[model samples]
Target: MTSEPTHAEASQTGTLRGSIGVAGIVFLVIAAAAPLTAIGGALPVMIATGNGAGAPMAYIVAGVVLLVFSVGYAAMSRHMVDTGAFYSYVHKGLGRSMGLGAAALALLTYTAIQAAVYGLAASTLRDLVVEYGGPDIDWWAWALGLIAIVAVLGYRSIDLGAKVLAVLLVLEVGIILALSVAVFARGGAAGIDVVSFTPASFFSGSPGIALMFAIASFIGFEATAIYGEEARNPKRTVPIATYVAVIVIGVVYAVSSWAVVLAYGSADVAAAATADTAGLTFGAAALFMGDTASDIMLIMLVTSLFASLLAFHNAISRYVFALARQGVGPRSLARTHTRHGSPHRGSLFQTLSAVIVVGAFAIAGSDPVLELFTWMSGLATVSILVLMILTGVAIVAFFARSDVDKRWWHTRIAPVLGCIGLIVITGLVVDNFALLVGGSSVLATLLLVLVVLVFIAGVLISKLSAGKEVDRSEHEESRT
Candidate 1:
């Protein structure tokens, strides 16, 4: 029998001294999902412009599709543990070329999502502060300050980020659940309408768009695998966190949205949402719980967005570290901190990128909510869907060739189905791309082209680097 691998061999590419368990991983993923922000910010827009009362069903549907995706995802995690999760998986299953492409795509998607939240967070904070009689500061100023804070947290140990996210997640979930309970006690205007669950309503107008938005809320759940290197018994921790995060996000979103619909009459939710797009959740809470509840929710929304920004920041840093370790990017980024055991180099780079992107928008005098937040979020949504589709394909390819576990469903059936589902969703997003960004068709097409170009660039860079390495090896052999 082979002896156990050395510590260095076991950790092929060094990571932090990770002791994170399932709970810490769950908190990170769920914090990225940002339940309070989704319910308070995105849900109202979905209800008003999407399938109205059917929005809750969209969350459930998206959750089910992702659960199928997770079956193979978890199965693969048992053998492969890399911080660049999507990239590494694809590299092992497909090829190095495709793996590098996935790395670029993952990096882009995470950065874009994090930037989107900064825009929203800064704008929300600006309004909240101004309303409370504080001096008016530009949204970008607030964004910059928050970015500095996130950079600091992300430059430390993973456990510190986990702990901070845990507190924020609890507060966000607590506020929303309290509102749901209040709604239950008071009974909504329609008094427990079952129509929200009816197929006719669920599949009504604009359901595809509703589904797209629903999928965005689950973005962080896929990231559970990204933390595999930091997890205790990653084989178990990753899968359990993946399933738990998805179910919690889906149920909380579904139940809270349904309660909101019930709080207002199902027939009137769309109109009510349209009238007070940003205030829908707060208004509902105030209706049942009192004015104080709405006030608390407003505060929680700001903190929720902050938690999400921090989560995404950590994810991007790890992806950068993973790629650098694999020789797919700048060599310096692979270095981890001696004291903190964190990828501080990557964290610093990511922070710098955030400042540049946010600063560009600030200098242009654009609307933080409409232009910065909306455009970045739209880009992230499309890019992430593409990554998920590629990952699903990678899972199928990886399992079909390897027989580590040899389970039929995990190896063959589930991954194929998940890929099909993602393919359909990708098509839907493409059809409604303009709606997603509130932009013209030309702009949407350009953004899509940019994503393609990024993937191609990564492939070309990887091929060239491999060629150079081969030449150097041959030269050394000739000298010998």
Candidate 2:
């Protein structure tokens, strides 16, 4: 077991506290709501149409790259346990400056994904509400309802969050798995098409475009660190959870995506996505749901989207709370509830931030996915890659500087390999940014640009805040 940060105050202490056990930890790591969010299914559909048999291979490739990155990430987490998100990991390993930039990026990346999903949820639900109730209500209103539910859950203990995630995880993974088996049971694609899981498929696309989608699929996994402050045992729990989450999710994606390729026939999968890539394709849903039942799947997806938004909102807030507690963001954001012991202030801020963003987009009439995932996802991926690379390097630097002796392979070899892989993958994703957000409405681009600008602005604000702290300290001494 590794030591958590002195600042965390050990929420469940001494009595075998972390209590989350392996079960809770696994659920948190899987983040079940994400796979069900339409992004996973859509990516597979796009791959089949755009690249032929190569799409599932892309997922395999992405999973491998991420698995390599997790080696160093989990290693670092074992030593440093702060809910500060990536910023904290980099800060302790790197410095205050790197931490600030990382924090800024995390905020933008997560918030954008959450809000974008809201737009998706709203649009899909609006259609559902009209069809089911024959009444047209504002989608934003429904989105507001989701925000409230997330706020309520966030107010509860972290363990409750884990429970909720566990239940959702089963649903998301179960449904996807069911579809995969159903497709395979019928010998749907005519053959197994085992070749779809190779590197050849990954490089077939412009590879750059496929990489961007691949990176987006992995974003939710990073939230594992946010649970650091709450984990039953940060050292053992964090490292294992980080690796397990990536590996498990990656495999599920590879298997499920390959299953889709087999079912649809590589030729058909690509075509479906190319036609309307971001929109949910209901061939399987329609198959299971019937013409009238198609509405049921749509409704379930909308629910999943809403849940994803809330989950992210919870993550972003915890990140802000982490920074605040360290005196980086507004000091008030750091406050935790005296009783629930939750990051009450941070949760409130996250919900409010999301509400403001959703309202802004609704007013501007923006395209949610294009705006949410494209630009925002791009920036987030960039930031996370930067953090992952820095964290990997930080592990090396800390061990070298501290003279903390450990196995060279655990400390050196793995991280070095991981860093190189991440650096390359991140560059590829960012370079092909346009491919990801292609033809998204102008408003979509502008809003994402604005989101990036906000992150940049955060860096400046962090610096100013640090300066004020120094000045205030000096003034107190002068008075003495």
Candidate 3:
């Protein structure tokens, strides 16, 4: 019985051997998260609600900060080879206990974000459907249908899902870029001004609120390491993916936000955000393209959100499978598919997590989007940031003592700076968690405590099992 798993595991590893190339990894970085890009939705809204024209600058601040964090993260990936992502990175950098804690955070954060995306997808689907005079399909129903689709895709080879995501991600970036460029070409509201993104705009939010959302929007960029096991060449591929993803996501945010700010003129930003439906980007769209053009953008926004949800579904599932493979979750979750070579056992639970999240929101008498945006998404951001900080720590530690070959830049100083940057950003965001969810810190504290507790327990268990392996290895050398 055990022999079969050992062979299947070997085979699973072998199947994705050379398949996912640099382009595939890049697609993974850009997936689902593109729609949630800070410039397109949050920043423009932030301009009116708090930041002013400086909202675009807020993204610049966040981007530079994250790029700093990536210095260490990518450096660590050069040495630590594991699909376990943060869990493994932290373990090698810190220890089993710390790694476990990171793992727990990974599970909660990934699953929460995955469920959160469902709520977003549902709301967008609901509105889009209603626009055509279709019956009001309940949000949960739409969420479940999407969850099912994600479950299926996640059950097969990762490349299958990657292909679909590449197409969707391309379309998402293309559509948003087209609209932003259209705004730029149409001109007039402010006539193509670069001053709108000046450094001073970073302070427009209530102290740190703009930074919180800015960092949150960049949450998925670090997921490049999550594909190490399936990537074509783990050592080289992961680092390139990590860097490319960060730059791409950052550039897109900067350009897109500047386009919006330019179209509307920074002066009218706050006024537009506070008005009736109050998210200024749409107003900017209408300002340049008329009501019909803005409406089309809204429709495209809806599609972008859906693609984002599906993208996240795949991410969270792999995270689940990673934890399970390490004996953190049920043993069955450690199993892999013989034919498709995906985390089939884990895929079953992907939608199952959505079911529970939906049921929880339904029981709480809250809207899914509210739950998604407020609770799950915020927690996910916190968790991933924590992982980034931990990854930086790991990179430093691994380079400090690892017998493996490494460079001084990849291992030492860069990672140290990355650690410092991530810790700072983490502190900033965690400090402003209440704002991210648009709720009281009191409630946010309780939620954070609950989530952290789960992460801690995962850490404890993993530490104890560090030297133990329930599934005996077929290869005597043993693998990461």
Candidate 4:
């Protein structure tokens, strides 16, 4: 009789293979953040509806908070290096139940964000096609087409995805930086006022709302650890990529938002944004670099969205792979392609999930940006903030129990501070949830409740699955 394969043997067969370095991991993380999409899309709305000229300061504030969070996060990565990332780290620190809970939340967070991007990407692509005299296709058709493309890329080698993201990220950042340089070189509309950075300006209008959006833009920075298994010298590369991704995203967002404020003049930016929320960034680009540049920026915007979709697709698939490997999800999802070494099963599942969600939205005749994008993105923002707070707590807990690396600042103080900051941000997200979703309070409440329900379900599932055998020996081997 043939012997049953042990979990260890099965895990070894499904292991991901790669040598992704710091830059490649950074490319994946930053691409998910989608700088151009944030600037052209989120920033204008933040200015008009949130903090006005003080929006740049909001990005700076959010960055500092996350930077503090990363201190403890980096320390934890050194010891618990796994592609499970937030899930694995939370599990290491908090125990099996909470880890499972975090894993579920992580899945929800990435999936929602990916679906949200699909909505926006579809809408943006539709508009671009019609503007250039292409067929006026439905947004869902474009979304399904993009999903198919992302599924293909994600099903290949991790390095291929990283390479594609690198090129797209460079182009996205290049155009945004060029536009910023032109604005600053011209000394802005009224000579580059410094008032936007003031404490008073930072508190102007709805600062909480502004901070929420700012924090949302930094969503993918923490994903550095998700590529740890594929990364070369992961103990060092993961931490370095984490810090670099955070700083790069922060500086780019703060500088670009500041430049936009300068382009319209501090006193007038709010009015300009309010008048033309969708066109605010494009208008500035046109004013500084000509209409041709603006058109290019439009094209880049669509690519930026595509890059984000691919990045998030990779992330969610890995999450599924990690969970399945640990016996928490379907065992089939843990399998990798023999040739590509990619989590092809997990990728297929994510692709199908996107299809169902996007298809439902289309059948409902929902507005892509207003309903699908706004609601799902808002849901993701809150879910991620909650996960960060949990991760911060878990980091402190893990260090407390283990004598691994007991630097007071890294293990205790920083994690505590990060948790506090994240908690405050979570409160902001809760209070302004309605505005964030662009919907009624009832809808916001329902969405927030959905996050809570998912966590509880994960915890319950963990309890029920306690008897399932999980081979963590492979993860331990990686650490060794």
Q: Best by TM-score, which number?
A: 1
Predictions ranked by TM-score, top down?
1, 4, 3, 2
Question: Can you list the residue pairs that collide in candidate 4?
Answer: none
**What overall lDDT goes with each candidate model?**
0.88, 0.68, 0.72, 0.93
1-480 in candidate 1: lDDT tens per residue? Answer: 989976644443467657889999999999999999889988998898889999899999888998898899888988988888888888888899998888888888988889999999999999999999998999999999999999999999999999999999999999899988888787788688777788998888788888889898888776788888888889889988888988888999999999999889899999999999889989999898889889989989999999999999999999899888888678778878766778888999999999999999999998999988888888888888888888888888887777787898988899888888888888888888898888579888988897898889888988998999999999999999
Cα RMSD, each candidate: 4.0, 5.3, 4.1, 4.4
Q: Tell me the lDDT of candidate 1.
A: 0.88
lDDT of 3 by residue, 145-251 (tens): 87777777777888887888888777777756776878878784767776657666656556366667777787677568877878877889888887888788878
Clashes of each: 0, 5, 5, 0
Q: In candidate 1, which residue pairs get closer than 3 Å at backbone N, Cα or C atoms, i.e. clash?
A: none
What's the C-alpha lDDT at position 381 in model 3?
Answer: 81
Enumerate residue pairs that collide in model 2.
Answer: 18-232, 48-270, 49-269, 49-270, 49-271
In angstroms, how far off is 24's CA in candidate 4? 0.4
Taking the tens digit of each residue's C-alpha lDDT, what string does model 4 give over 396-439? Answer: 99999999997999999999999999999999989999999985
* Deviation in Å, model 4, residue 152 alpha carbon: 0.4
Question: How much lDDT does candidate 2 score?
Answer: 0.68
Span of ten consecutive residues with least summed lDDT in model 1: 8-17
Q: Could you give me the TM-score of model 3 versus the true structure?
A: 0.90
For lDDT, the strongest prediction is 4
Ranking by lDDT: 4, 1, 3, 2
